[model samples]
Target: MPDAVMPREAAAALKGDAALPQKCLDCGQRIGWVELFFSLFLGLFKLTIGIISNSHALIASSLYSAQDFFSSIIVIISMKYQKRPPTEDYPYGFGKIEYVAAGALCLAVFLGAITLLIAATRVIFAGVTHPAHWVAFWAALVAFGANVMLYRYSECAGHRLGSPAILTTSEHVKGDAVSSILVAVAVLGTKAGIHHLDPLIAILEVAHIIFMLYHMLKQSVGGLMDAALPEEEQEQIRTLVTAVDGVEQITDLKTRAYGQSNEICVEIELDPSLALAATAPIRNAVKDTLLKGLVKPSTVKIYLAPAGEGRALASSRQQAVREALARYYLGHVKRHHLEITPSSVALRLTFYSQVLPGMRKQICAAVGTNIENNIEDGTVSVSEV
Candidate 1:
């Protein structure tokens, strides 16, 4: 939604450390803890200096730090649960929990901004003024420098891991450094008996926080709704899948994020005449390529379409009805048939011709393992002709 998001080319430029896993739970956990510790330290340090100096700007910045501390803790907690394998109750796994945590963090930042704005307004309206406290000034300087270092480190980890949650947290740190400088300048202005500058600085910082909150909320909701991958990412996936040795073309590709991880599903075009023996290795090639290059252990479903017959083969009754039953009991059979009652037209599916006898059982096992994949209620009866 926001034009501020990185473009595809820019995001793609962020290559990983050759040694890093496409996705790593340990990396996610480490980044969460790093941000948590950094926020906690800054919050306590700033609060101490703010109270000693009696500077409203310092106090406001410190409260923001406190909010960050809370948000980071939530992230740390989510990272632990988000790695749980998909269960019967939660079929998609708990990766989306990271997005939920991100949403909460945004909410906290927004509320903190409101509170800061209210306090700044009180100082403005009540003609309350305090001299710039030297102690607060020094504290802000140290906080700013520390934030810079943390932001760089977090950014490196975020890109290497391709974790949106980590990337967002790193961006927060960068923004906080800028806010610290603004607060420091306001403190100096207040000490010069220019108290008006305090409210102005607060207003600017609050405005930024409001926009960031909107962005975070939008992204969080999009992930929950299973939004399509950004157009550029889709193109990259397409290029990668099609370039694989045996893939003819890409029919469709779908991607959605779960917390800090990515999931991709692809439907591929293939030559019908290729020996059934060749299909498995080709499918595996596409899968291995994606797993190694793009997503970390993502679920990839490949739909094999015989060239030219793609459309005619898909919606025909024989393929449709038989596919449903095959998916249920035969483990994803290739040969199936269905007849339209009204027209008494017959449709034939020759998927069996696409696989070798030895491998049919394995392929079937994969297809039939998930009964929920059945698109129709279990009612089809088998008949011998």
Candidate 2:
């Protein structure tokens, strides 16, 4: 029931105004409700039929369906947490805690597969017999119809929500559908006096369960690991970061996925002339660009650095101190530059702004304060640019 919208579609769906948190909660709730109904139906029908047929496979399938129903209830409870405001203990928000639900579901499937296989093997070796249970046959047919209907609905909902949990549940339904078919055939075979077929089909159904479990496990693990964004997303992100205005070079770009969303971090080297005051706006612009066109995460971090000059020239005497300061502060006003000029004078030179050029004494006093506090003295002479 999670509405699986692509990044673009999700934005569009929220057009003109922000989408309500309630919308997301409702989607999760609706999906859970549908699954709950189907699960109950499957569980009750299978248990009834299983009892009448004395079929171990039918009984095991019923128990598994019951588990699925209960697990979905857990997911429903977790859905409310998904909407809870972040607290001190849970920082990254509760959105990703859904993955914990997925991991649990994976464990459930794994255990169910193991249990079913073990039970089937025991029944087969124990020479258990299945009766010609007409009631069980009809019940299975009804359950199969329900499975088909639930599978169709869940599949569509899963794709729309882009929820791995819903998708996994859909797949489980599909497996159950297949097993239902095998159950029908085996039941008929038993009724026809071909006694061995029921256990054989049960064993075959175990394979389907195993396949479903593996698929779910892969998805659950991938989310928990914070795996890197897909290749296409990475390429798009690189392009977006490099295209930002004033960015000289980008290094240490990294991205990771949290469920369907992504988080990105990058270190940028820019002209030192850029003002420090400009850092906030530029970082915001980059984040917006990525969110609009490339990757949108709960957060993005941008690290700023100098382009090329100041630090490398620190040991070289010939470099103009004024030019170094100019280049260093080009992109931002808050960043300072220290430069050394004219070799062998053993004197210091400094470059700074004289905001109140008329008050020579105040300017000189301010320059001294700026240097002593912001930079180490004796490295460069201070001068008005």
Candidate 3:
């Protein structure tokens, strides 16, 4: 028989840390300010140049900058909701808001792509009458420099904080960098009398937007459905749990991400011979081990089951015991545990029996002799599974 296990919530909260959320908030703010500053600066700069120099490629890139600038505001706003503690009305917290913000950014990218492509197609057919002025080249160069800086900072903070929004925004900024380079090339091409290449650069910008939008859409949908963590991370979690002493085997394990962090649930099998008091420390140790390896969970559930007969390897030995005993009319045996010591063995169990109080002694004698084979010193308590 296995001892009663500790409550999973108490065990998971043994560390009592929710560092991931706050970390994400700080990362978002740092990256958000960068997003806003550069977008506003470059959007106006390129838009003004595109109109003055008659550069369609620069015009397309300006629309993208405007989209990025507004999406950064969304990212900053979403962080406010994500920073709140779990409330009674919302047990899992507001991690999904970041995902919503991500989706919105992707939508913004898609819309900008459409707008850019439409303007590019019109420019492609219209034919360039004159090359862009030298000022357009300098504008693209400056925009590329700004995007490169934003991408580095955002990529660093995104990976460190494990924020999908920051990472997505970084990709957006990278697209801007590439767009700026293409605009620079298009201006040079047009100056050299190849007017068609200008719209080609704008078409390339749309391709980048489509690629990023696909990724953002997939992740946002998966996050809402409580998708599992990556395969590598899941394997790491499994290895940590298996390393704990006295843990016979993992019966079940599950992990899912909410806002910025993840939640884990684990059920393990333990030796039947261990007493209830002995199992408590092992439970705490396992929880602590998990805490070290994984994020603080929004809801973690852990259960312990005995290893042997009723649960472990019942296929060959206990299969016959369960079927024959039920026919012999003892009861439906929920679980049976046997502990062996030098020269003696003990049996402890729980089951449901309909036998009257008057027939209890007869049933006990029959249970000991027929099923357990030596239930002399121990007792069988009636219960439900």
- lDDT of each candidate versus the true structure: 0.66, 0.60, 0.68
lDDT of 2 by residue, 1-385 (tens): 0011223233223333456433543665698787987798788889777877776557656755765575566457555665565565675556566567766766765776677778778877888655547666677777778888888877766665455566667777776766676778777888888777777777776676666566656766776787777788778877887888877778667776654345677766656655444554666676667766642333465766556773243334333333333433442223233323111112222223433345433443444444344333333344433
Off by over 4 Å in 1: 1-27, 295-297, 317-385
Instruction: Rank the candidate models, highest lDDT first.
Output: 3, 1, 2
lDDT of 3 by residue, 1-385 (tens): 3333222222232235556445544666677787888788889999899889878788878866876786677667766677776675786678788677777777876887787788778777887666677788999999999889888988877765556677777877888888899899999998888888877877777776677678878988899888998898878877987899999989887878765567777777777666555766777777777665563343445666667753543232234334435644445444555433222233444454554544555544454555344233333332222
Q: How do all the candidates rank in terms of TM-score, highest first?
A: 1, 3, 2
Candidate 1 lDDT trough over 10 residues, lowest sum = 1-10
| Candidate 1 colliding pairs | 132-191, 276-354, 318-338, 331-364, 331-368, 334-351, 334-352, 335-351, 335-352
Q: Which candidate is the best by TM-score?
A: 1
Stretches of candidate 2 off by over 4 Å are: 1-25, 107-112, 131-134, 191-194, 243-250, 259-261, 277-282, 294-298, 306-385
Cα-based TM-score, every candidate: 0.75, 0.67, 0.71
What lDDT tens digits, residue by residue, belong to model 1 across residues 78-162? 6678657678578667878867776777777678778878877887788855665788778889989998998888787767666
lDDT accuracy of residue 100 in candidate 2: 73
User: Which candidate leads in lDDT?
Assistant: 3
Clashing pairs in 3: 1-337, 95-259
